[model samples]
Target: MGKNIDDYIDKGLKGTPETKPSERREYLSQLRERIILALTNGQVIQQKPYKPISDLMKRYPSSKLYLDGDLDYMHLSKYIRIANENNIPFTIVDDKASSTNIGLVLANPTAIDKDDIFVSREEFQRHL
Candidate 1:
């Protein structure tokens, strides 16, 4: 059909379409619904790791950790250590093409539709 041909041509010309490109950029290439936890660059840079993150990793052992490759490894290493301790797979997303304020994300491959994925600074501090 003409529409099918157009679709194929479009795909060839523009590459495959991505869902919620902006959201993915903001969440370090993961969908919002799939994220179990997200931390801002500032949060990740704190001297201590967010306390609940370790527990969350234990709760969702199958989840993957996405760290912003833009930051130095020292800023990200605490969480990386936790991921290693929990056996949660981790990735450093070096998305030079896009800029994001989010420095870390813990997410599943499938959508979890979690409503409270971001931890407020107050809650994070209290947990620490």
Candidate 2:
């Protein structure tokens, strides 16, 4: 894998795919789009070149989802499904409360709640 974006940007991460701020946002935006489209279509959304986020969501219930740190869809989907499976609960703060600070939060991974499965990032990013 390429170096994480943060690593190259400022020695903050430890992975490949070093991405510029705008690049990461744009890439994440694209992913968020794919996920929402898949969910609406009731089809499986594949995170091409990476893990599939939809696959994991399909396995969970709807709770136990939380958006805190930056997370890719592939990983968030798993976290959501697991929460649903375990009946755990979480929530996604408003985009205003997001750490991305881009006026747009792409969920890298989003938060989930018992009654509300945060469709914010995917849902919101969809139209963007």
Candidate 3:
């Protein structure tokens, strides 16, 4: 009972414990298993938007788009347009403390447990 009280107090003081906080920070507040697609900061700034992202957005209307606020809005604007066009909700994760290269993540509220969540530029070109 004493331990339980201490734990409750700790929770109240520090907020609730999160699972895999580093991974969450890297993946823009979403778990790896829940991400349907992830793009690096460079990838998100490419001359053209990746087609697979639009396709995935169309396929997963229930999914949400997470954009890194660390990047310039110009880099994220294209995706924001895609999300709006798809009618999917989006959030900009602007954590200055987060040191991740990932710039965009499309995740379902529930875990989908996908093994391949990243699309490389080579893969995108081959598919194009």
Candidate 4:
């Protein structure tokens, strides 16, 4: 037989390439792993999606999360309490209430202050 069981044993072997190929898959996998690690360590601060109420339970792992919108009694009254209990900072701004009219901006806090939840025309515009 030209081929035998031994020939098929190295099934995991990939074809040898003639030229240098892009490491796209490897790069993407590394990036994904880093993201998951960041999230796991709380190094990756999170935010709700642009529209529709974003699910906080899955990411935050606690009630500490903010709901965007002043107009929605749902956001202000209910979610704020959850954030309070969860130790998550919450803010209400122009963006939360009127998403298309204004967008939201996320920030990390530095010296002299806790992380800020900034929402304003100037801040949102500057982010753009």
Candidate 5:
């Protein structure tokens, strides 16, 4: 006879130990490297837009929005308008913030120009 579903569930319910800080740091470093390689090799990373400008501003009151240099003019204008409406400060910068508390990154690969020298994920990590 096959094992009951409850048996499998019971086994799965046994939680594993949490990752140590050092191990987590190493894993994150490796993940960062992989992402950088992918970006440098012409890969695009699509991040899901999660929060509204107002919510984000409220959460990180001190954060400045760093707009990518190659962002589309129309989108940039829209973001600026939204920021203004929400009373959030922002700037166009070559580098993105490494820490979330300091700044928010807004980059759209489709909006980038072919001739523009876009910063790679690796460079951003180094700045962090």
Candidate 6:
């Protein structure tokens, strides 16, 4: 049985002819061209719009809002604007001590501290 298996493997290996250098090169060139064409004419991917945290707050009014320390400024600004407009209170807490500029927007008048700078929705609109 071992001898028969060995003969079968040898027959299978010998049946396929090795590709010539020129033929191999031409085949590779064609594959490269196809890949380049596919890449150049590829479909344009569309990104979904960013959903602000304030939108979520509107849906769930009592939900606690916690912004990540590493979030993009533009995205954060959108949430801040929405929160400010709707009088939704939000706290920006950073677990990392290195992040000194953690933003905290308080809509509730009672929660305001002496040191905290108060900015009304009208002021935010004027700046915009």
Question: Which candidate's TM-score is highest?
Answer: 3
lDDT-based ranking, best first?
1, 3, 5, 6, 2, 4
Model 2 earns a TM-score of 0.23
Clashes of each: 0, 21, 0, 0, 0, 0
In model 1, the worst 10-residue window by lDDT is: 119-128
- Residue 49, candidate 2: alpha-carbon lDDT: 15
Instruction: Report the C-alpha displacement of residue 74, candidate 4, in angstroms.
Output: 5.6
Query: By the TM-score metric, which is better: model 2 or model 5?
Result: 5
The Cα local distance difference test for each model comes to: 0.93, 0.35, 0.90, 0.30, 0.39, 0.37
The RMSD (Cα, Å) of candidate 4 is 17.9
After superposition, the stretches of candidate 4 with alpha carbons farther than 4 Å from their true spots are 1-64, 96-98, 101-128
Compose the digit string of candidate 6's lDDT tens values, residues 37-117: 110001101121123334544654543333433445555555556656656655544444333222332222222223423
lDDT of 1 by residue, 58-122 (tens): 88878999999999999999999999999999999999999998999999888899998888888
Q: Each candidate: RMSD to true structure?
A: 1.5, 13.7, 1.3, 17.9, 14.9, 23.7
Give candidate 5's whole-model lDDT.
0.39
Best by lDDT: 1
The residue pairs that clash in candidate 3, if any, are none
User: Who is ahead in lDDT, 2 or 3?
Assistant: 3
When sorted by TM-score, best at the front, the candidate numbers are: 3, 1, 5, 6, 4, 2
How accurate locally is residue 115 in candidate 4, as Cα lDDT from 0 to 100? 32
By TM-score, how accurate is candidate 4?
0.26
Q: Which stretches of candidate 2 lie over 4 Å from their true place?
A: 1-65, 97-128
Reference-based lDDT, residue 97, model 5: 25
124: Cα error in model 5, Å: 23
Task: List runs of model 1 lying over 4 Å from the truth.
Answer: none
Candidate 3 C-alpha lDDT tens digits along 58-116 = 88889999999999999899889989999999999999887899999999989899999
